[model samples]
Target: MRALFWLLSIFALAAGLAIVARYNDAYALFVWPPWRLHISLNLLAILSVGLFALLYMATRLVARALALPGAVAAFRAQQRKQRSIQALRDAQRFLVEGRYGRAHAQADAAYRANESPGLAALIAARASHAMREHVRCEEWLRRAAEHDREVRVARLMTEAEFAVADRRFDVAAERLDALRQGGHRHIAALRLSVQTAAARGMWGDVLRLARQLASHRAFTAEQAAPLVRRAHLESLRELEGNPEGMVRYWRQIPKPERNDRGLVRDAALLLNASGQGELAAEAIGDALDDNWDSALAELYGRIEGGTLIERIGQAERWLRAQPRDERLLLTLGRLCLQQQLWGKAQSYLEASLSVAPSRAAHLELARLAEQLDRNELALKHFRSAAELTG
Candidate 1:
């Protein structure tokens, strides 16, 4: 369709030119001292149009010639820019590949080539850190901050990570605090805070940061559970010998955290050790009622100062649900002995041994025998527990 339109337009243009030529019969004459020249009006018009077209073409050529040097320089600069970008990419790839030396070299070259110097310096810093070049790592990190003010947070994060790696908890804590105060507490910053807190044995801080990370979905439930549990355990251990402090700490822990069986058991054990057996018993009972844990039930037996008869009643209630749990049986044996129910204590101890012959059950049986004045039977039980230990 376009070709047909162009064909018709060409014919119409030719017919219009023919009509103008046929009607334009006027002429023009010019005279000089020795020569005279005459030309038709149509011929004059054609020459003038052709002359303008030639001049336009010539001017365009000259302009292009004049601009040639700048165009060449621009092309070279573009090539250099591409090379610098490629160098940065290579640096990142090498860093991921664990080729630290190569990564550092590429990053430095990219920095020299003026391609995101701040980012390049950060990559170099990471490479230096991987190579165990601590001094160089710090220098690169400083250079990164100097190159771009916006990258200072990134610089601080890198420094904090390095400090954590070096076990320099104090330095890491300072950097992390600075990040927080600057309103730059991103996921990575929070994760580094967790590491730094753990390194410093600051269990409270570790727990706080870990909970923050978990809330952000930075860690899966599986990963977060153990870390939170460990932090809680360590915090409970730190509160040892201070029953008041342990009680305060326990109350401060979130209810969801207290729901974890392992964490609850650790806290209960710590509480019992500090002569807060009532607190331990209460915690253990709450946890077991929510979700039964055999290990925690066993820990229930070791608590010293709680009402033994009440604990025994609680264990029996749990027994209705878990009749075959040997740990619960062992706990019942111990709780019965505490209440001086000699017959029931012997029955639970023997029942626990029949289900699972643990050395602990043997020891409990020996103690029960001693309480019953069966010296020979106590000696035999002691010998059997010794063999199991060996």
Candidate 2:
């Protein structure tokens, strides 16, 4: 259609020029002194203008004719590219929907058709992973890595996760080490490293990775504390066969972290074992100041003092600060009973039961009432304790 339009346009232009040449008359009105000329002015001017226009149109036609094949080639290439992109998108959708087989097929087709081999390999790897075809996943991931080092790091990280899922701790650790060595220590890599270290019971490695992660702000301080505490405890536990080694290990932990409940508890138990009651009591006191705990309460009650009064006084001080603390109240009541402060002990125990009734509280109160020669009240508290337990 365009060809016909150009042809018609050229013919009309030529005919119009011919008509102007045939009708218009040119009379030479003047000449320069050294020159002599005679011409039909309209015909010559029209023919010159028409020839220039024709030449321009002809040149344009030649250029377009020459470019037509390249244009067609480019258009076809674009369409093919579009198809490859569409195939990749479909594969991604299929993978997201968990249709692994279809996703693999689509990704394979896209891989063959697309120029972005790295992206195609990624899709293929994901599809293979979803299908549990680990061998195929590794092959595709390797292809991706070869295409780009950034892609390689990403592929290795994914592989590490898969290894961990398969309980391949050693392989996961190796992969994490490679990632860290390659300077690809992103949050995901650090997190996986932490998990792998923990799974392998590599406390040293766990502590190192956790500290790295915390330093990078990958986890909040609160989030990382428990893992750090656990790692420290595990390290200490390993030295249990050697008393000097265990004590040295305990001493090495920072004072602030040693104040944590888990570490404090472990230290108290260890101290009690080593017959260091005074140090254990001090540690327990520090731990309770941070948080009230039933275990700590019981541990405090078992410590030796001059008389039960001294212990009871210590507990009453704790209760004064935490008035509604049932655990402290119960502990204070038990200590008072031992000191023969029956009225104070009974009132405190009753207050504890009123706030939060428990088998332990009832039993303690029953024992306190018996000590006071209140047999009826003692029996009643004992029955309540039994019912609560049952």
Candidate 3:
């Protein structure tokens, strides 16, 4: 529609000009060097318009010629940039595919092209590490650091992972420490630190990180259970033979962990081994009141050197709640025996044997019979215990 309008306007203007030229006679005369010349004003105006159009076309041609070199250079630069981007993408794909050699080559190409050089160098470093080219890996990491300061965290994390993989726990620990000091303690870093500590047998560190990871939801409660349990158990084991240290360590554990029956039981046993029998008995008594474990109840009776009356009272209270538990009866019998309550001890031990027929119960009854000077009863109980042991 616009083209039609322009065509019609041009025709109308031409018709009007033709009508004017035909009706009005206009002339122009010029002389130079004694020569006379004459031309119509319309012809002179037509020549002037044609000359302006030619000059405008010539100027445009000259401008285009002058700008050609820069345009060609821009096109070449665009091609190089595209190639660099493609190389970077290829490097990423190869890395994911586990094609370390190809990935390293592609990443090197990308780095040479200066396309995100830091990230490319990091990729190269990882590939080199995968291929066991330690020297090359270190060099690439150094280059990555030089190229981009923003990749410092990434560089350290990668190095720490490799250190862990190579069993260089000290190196991994150093790297993790640097990460923490630099405020780079993300979930990934925390996980790596946990693994490093575990590999180094740094149980205390492992326990600390496992708690942190659980709180951060890095792992579910079920998934983190074994790690938490093992770390805490191992840490307790390290405090063996030192009653003061064991007590201090137990006190230092979080209340929730300290309250765990398994932990409490182990801690108590360790305390018992360290000759803190009173403390050991106290720990077991508190745990039994909160939650009952048959094995733990049995362990409670083995603790000595505490107040016999108080311990007997504690066992009797538990018996009221668990009337039929054979282990509880056995524990009560042992505690009564320690207090020299022969009649009560014999009755409880016999009741335990009636309930479970355990060798331990029979043996305890045999000892009680011997204390009462009943050689015949003691011999009978010992024979029964031997049969049960068989």
Candidate 4:
């Protein structure tokens, strides 16, 4: 409607102009040095109008021609972007569908197409690793590393994990050590590094990494404590036959942690194996202060210079505190047998059996009865023990 209004207005102005031209009879005269001409005002107006139309058309044609190349380039760039997006989608679909071979192909195509090279390289690496293609995985990981320096640490860490998965522990360790030395000690990277070190029996490195992980809360105290202790234990084991060095290594552990039941138990067993019974007993006693364990009870029972009566008294005290504790009752009964308190031993053994019958408890009780010359009771307990053991 606006265009129509403007067109009618232009027509009315032209008619008014024509009427004015008729009345005035004015003409426009043109002179070039060699020629002179004259035209009616209306005709000149018409000619001017036609010339303006021609100029406008020509300007539009020139502008369109000027923009053609850039327009084409932009269109082509958009098409390339679309194709790259499609390729990435296809690669992701293949990966999700467990079509690793196709995923590899699609990722390679995406990479060659210059579509997010880093992402494509990562996809190819993961797909190859899934297929157990270690060489291909490494190549893709290396390519990813070369493409983006910012992701170099992450790529190298991935390669190290793959090496560890492939049981190439030495290579994994080398890569991990290099990354750590370069200050790329991300938590996952450090964890894999520790595992690699452990696989290679590098207990010192394992201990160091475990401590670092523990400090950062990457692992819980309970989880990391054992690994640290095991690393120390292995270090001590390596120094076996060198008693002085072993003792020094064992003593290096902090008092509080060294006194932990699990750590102390393992240390005691190790010391005992190395003919360090006195130290083993001391460690055992230290562990027993915090927690009572049947294994520790048995270990304590084997020590000398403590009479059977004293040991029995200790076991009875423990049992009194936990009357229904079958293991403690059994231990007490065995201690009583050692002290030749046959009646008390029988009573404790019967209580243990009533709480939780076990072949071992029955056997101990039968042995005690036999020693006390209660033949009938001994025979019956022996038959029960035999039945349970069978």
Candidate 3 pairs with clashing backbones: none
The lDDT of model 1 is 0.89
Alpha-carbon runs more than 4 Å astray in model 2: 1-42, 89-106, 262-279, 293-295, 302-313, 332-357, 361-385
Query: Residue 32 of model 3: what lDDT?
Result: 98
Candidate 3: tens digits of C-alpha lDDT, residues 1-390 = 999999999999999999898876788899897898889989988998999999999999999889999989999999999999999999999999999999999999999999999999999999999999999999999998896576888888988999999999899999999999999889999999999989889987888899899999997877667778778778768877777887777667676666677777777877888888898898788778878888889998989769999889889999999988999999999999999998899888888877889989988988988888988988998999899878
Write candidate 1's Cα lDDT for 1-390 as tens digits: 999999999999989998989999888898997989899999998999999999999999999999999999999999999999999999999999999999999999999997999999999999999999989988898789887575777788888888888888899999899989989888988888888888778887777788788889998888788889998888778778787988998888878888898788777878888988898899889888988889988999988877888889999999999999999999999999889898999899899999989899899889989988999999999999999999
Over 1-390, each residue of candidate 2 has an lDDT whose tens digit, in order, gives 999999999999989988877887765545888887777787457578899999999999999999999999999999999988888888889988999898888888888885567777888888898788989998988888877744677677777988898899999999888888888878998899899999999998888888888889998889888889889878867866676776667667777777787777776776656555566677778778777787787667666433466567777778777888777778777777777788888888888888899898898887877776889988998999999989
- Off by more than 4 A, model 4: 1-27, 32-57, 66-70, 89-97, 138-151, 221-229, 232-268, 275-313, 337-347, 369-380
Instruction: Locate the minimum summed-lDDT window of 10 residues in model 1.
Output: 147-156
Model 4, TM vs. native: 0.75
Which candidate number has the best lDDT?
Answer: 1
lDDT of 2: 0.81
Q: Report the number of the highest-TM-score candidate.
A: 1
- The better candidate by TM-score, 1 or 4, is 1
Reference-based lDDT, residue 324, model 2: 87
lDDT at position 220, candidate 4: 93
Clashes of 2: 0
